[model samples]
Target: MAFGRNKNRRRQDAAQRNEAVKGAVRSKGPGVMKVLALTLATGLLVWGGVELRRWALQSPRFELAAVSFSGLQRASRVELLRLAALTKGQNLWALDVGALERTMLQHPWVKKVEVSRRFPNRVSVAVTEHVPEALAVLGELYVLDEEGEPFKRVTPGDGLDLPLVTGVDREGYVADPDQARQRFQAALEVARAYTKEAVAGKPERLSEVRMEGRDVTLVAASGQEVRLGEGDSEVKLQRLARVRRELGARGLAAEIIHLDNRARPGWVAVKISSPVSERNGSAKQ
Candidate 1:
């Protein structure tokens, strides 16, 4: 009886140990399955992303079908297209927008460029061109914008009737951009003043604005040169307008008008050839 009881106790202990092992295994099984599932999901996501990228690159849906350009004045659309190298049937997803923009900016006329991928098979380009304001004579003639920035070199038959800005060299501009800019600003100011004072129905056109240090010499369309020494250009210009009106009223023309004296702002020294009547009277005398 004792032996049978010991045997029965042993059997019960073994059965309990087996049940505990099975319960622990059952608890850890779901955790292992969850880890495996998470790893598989991550892998699938990575593979799916890679496949999507591949599809996007190789898919016909993402291929460029058309290219459109806008805000182009001087830059040719065909030239820009050639520079961009974006051909039809090229993968839109593979294009480098920044590179294309840099390529377009290589053209001197383009001030600003914007490139974008229009969804579903189109690329769009928008450009802002530099507007020529005057011709800056620096070795070769270069186009000066309103901001006094020299943007492009002129070719033959450009047919720009703008004012000429002299005394600005490439060396000066390269050595001191700020000083060059200030000089150009002053030149533009002088040009504006001249333009504002129109005689008759036509605008007063300037032939050239020569800069000498801080002083400026303006050559008019009528072959008269005005020496406007620095300080208070507005006042000087006002006095100049009066002088011009007086001369026009008397049907007189001056070879040179000097308004360089600041203290005598109202005074002007005009050089004129003696009239035919005065010359004939002097001859008779």
Candidate 2:
């Protein structure tokens, strides 16, 4: 009987050990499944985000509907659009703003460009064109800006009244931009001085300004050549004004006026056409 009891007790202990093992396995199963569920959820979210981005990029809603321009003075809208090469129906998100900006700036007349995209379907372009201050007479005519930088090539029907700047070669300017800039500044100064109205209320309209090395020569609208030596341009211009007034008072017109001699600031040497009385007397003799 005691031996029977021992066998029964051993069988009971074995059954308890089996139950503990099964319970432990059951406890770990939910935790493992939770981890797998979290991993699957994360993967699904990432895939959905990528797909949504792709759809948004290729969607018709992002198609460019219009392109607008502003601040354009010289550059035409059609020309700028052609240079940009941006076509309608192109995906706005796919369009490269930086690339378009660089292309537009390639136009010499376009000094600066601002490119931006309007959400839902539009591109805006703002262009700042180079303001022409004068015409530089190179082999071919070119436009000069206020900073004395040549920005564009000139064509017919342009700058009819602008003063012509001569004695600077295009090749030389390209080789030495700094020196060319200085020359342009000097020419601009002379042109401005010649065009400015003096205290006598008379403005000298210049047709051409020639830069001979450091000295400047001005050709007035009346076809008189005025030689202005380098430096002290204001003083020289004042003297020129006085000379002009004196000539008008004396009923005399000069063919040429030389103010280049710095030693004689107050003296002006003028060459005038022979008076009518003198011409008549000589004819009689």
Candidate 3:
């Protein structure tokens, strides 16, 4: 009876151990499945990223949709459109925006450019065109914009009433040069200001404003010369404009007004040229 009881107890213990082993195996099976699922998910994500990049570069869905511009007058719409290499069928993601911007900036008239991508199928471009402030008659002929930047090299366009700048050499127009064009710029400003206020309304009011070395001279419509001295130029220009307004009614007298004096109270000299009657009387005498 004692041996049989011991055998029964051993059988019960073995059965319990077998049940515990089966429970552990069941738990480990789920853990292995979870790890396999995560690995597959990671691989799919990486593959999707690569496919997306390939599609972005090669697909035609992101092609250019439209071309637009601003601050452009001298250049026609068609001409500007032609200058841009981006067309309706060109891929937006494939284009180098930097290279395109550089090309547009080379147009002589284009001052700034902005490019943006609209997903799915659109690219937009915004451009700021250079406005010509003066006609720079350099060796190759360029239009000088407001910032004194020379751009286009075309013949003078119509309806431009700005001053014409001449005698500026090639070195003066380099990307960055000395103050060679400073004097010319000053002359241009004076001319523009004078025209805007006094002369532009009266076409032939002043014929030419010639800068000879350092001195600035103004040639009147009636063949008279007005001298503007070096330094303190704004005051000298003001004096000249005042004189022109005062004497313009008389239509530019045969006199020369010299405002070269900045400290000694300034002076104006007139060559009376002897009256016609006096000349006649002298002839009779």
Candidate 4:
């Protein structure tokens, strides 16, 4: 009876151990399956992303169909397109937008450029060109923009109808850029103010604005010269208009009008070939 009881207890313990082993395996099995599923999902995502990129690179749907440009004046469309080296049927995703913009900026007339892709097949290039406002002589003729910045070298294809600003040379500009810009700016200011004035019932065009240190002398297309001093350009220009109007009514023309008198404020000196040409007075505007 004792041996049989001992054998029954041993059988019960073996059964319990087997159940615990099975229960532990059941808990660990789901954890292992979850790890494998997560790993497979991650691998599929990576593969899908790589495949999408490859497809986009060679897809006809992403081919470059059209290229558009805006704000182009001095820069021709053909020139810019040649610089970009983009062809129709080329994949848009393959083009480097940053490199394309830098290439476009190599053109002398292009001041600012922005390149963007219109999804599915188009690219646009918007450019801001440097507008030539005047011509300056700095060892070589250069085109000056509205900001008095010399941007481009003068070419035969460029328009030459703009006013000329002289006196600052290339050496001076290279040594002192700020000084040069300020000098050009002063001359440009005078030119802008003179544009609104006319002489002898005819519109006088500003031909040249010669800078001599701080002094400014304006030469018109009509061969009329005005000796304008520094500062108060607009007010002095108004006085110049009145002088021209008075001279025009009197059937006379001044070879030179001096409104740069520092000693006598508001005084003007008019010089001409006629007998009534020697005139000086407070020609207050």
Question: Could you say which candidate leads in lDDT?
Answer: 4
Positional deviation of residue 212's Cα in model 4 after best superposition, in angstroms: 1.1
Models 1 onward score TM values of 0.80, 0.74, 0.67, 0.82
- Identify the runs in model 2 with alpha carbons over 4 angstroms from their true place: 1-49, 157-160, 198-202, 273-285
lDDT tens digits by residue: candidate 4, 1-285: 999999999999999999999999898989989999999999999999999999999889999999999999889989988898877888988989999999989898999999999999999999999878899998889999888999989999885689999899999999999999988888887887777555333557889999988889999887888998777988888898888889888887787899999998599999863444334543322
lDDT on C-alpha atoms for all candidate structures: 0.85, 0.83, 0.66, 0.87
lDDT tens readout by residue for model 1, 100-126: 999999888899999999988999999
True lDDT of residue 268, candidate 3: 52
- Candidate 4 overall lDDT versus native: 0.87
- Stretches of candidate 4 above 4 Å error? 1-39, 198-202, 274-285
True lDDT of residue 24, candidate 3 = 86
Order of models, best TM-score first: 4, 1, 2, 3
List ranges where model 3 is wrong by over 4 Å. Answer: 1-43, 57-60, 156-159, 171-176, 199-207, 220-224, 248-256, 262-265, 270-285
lDDT of 2 by residue, 99-156 (tens): 9999999988889999999989999998988777778867778898877888878877
Worst 10 residues of 4 by lDDT: 276-285
